[model samples]
Target: MEYTVVENSGYDREKDVFSHTSYWEAFSYRARHYTDSEIREMHVEIAIDLPDGTRTYEI
Candidate 1:
């Protein structure tokens, strides 16, 4: 599976930024920049690619 870390730090949906290729890498990036509370408030998520389809969940 592949993973992507999305930063939803703005109001413009089209301008959301994302990065990373693995869950651990993505989690590390988020951990460095945001506290657990901030992450929940910002709606940060990790998008995962599976054989079935892409899925997302709060980080």
Candidate 2:
């Protein structure tokens, strides 16, 4: 399955602004699923910071 991080945040130091980068929740239904390692890599891929030990539902 493909991996996607729905909940996205952006920080604009020049403007000091942050907002939702995606319209879907990180763990919402109908959204793409991601592995633990992928989640960690995603933090850098998406340039969004995720809290330590983030987890997603699989059912």
lDDT of 2 by residue, 11-51 (tens): 23222122233524424422245556654644312223334
Q: Estimate each model's TM-score.
A: 0.58, 0.25
Q: In model 1, what are the clashing residue pairs, if there are any?
A: none
lDDT computed for candidate 1: 0.63
lDDT of 1 at 28: 85
Clashes of each: 0, 0
Local lDDT at 5 for model 2: 38
Where in model 1 is the C-alpha error above 4 Å? Answer: 9-16, 49-55
lDDT tens digits by residue: candidate 1, 1-59: 66666656333562234555678887787788778997778766666656587554533
Report every candidate's CA lDDT. Answer: 0.63, 0.34
Model 1 RMSD in Å is: 3.9
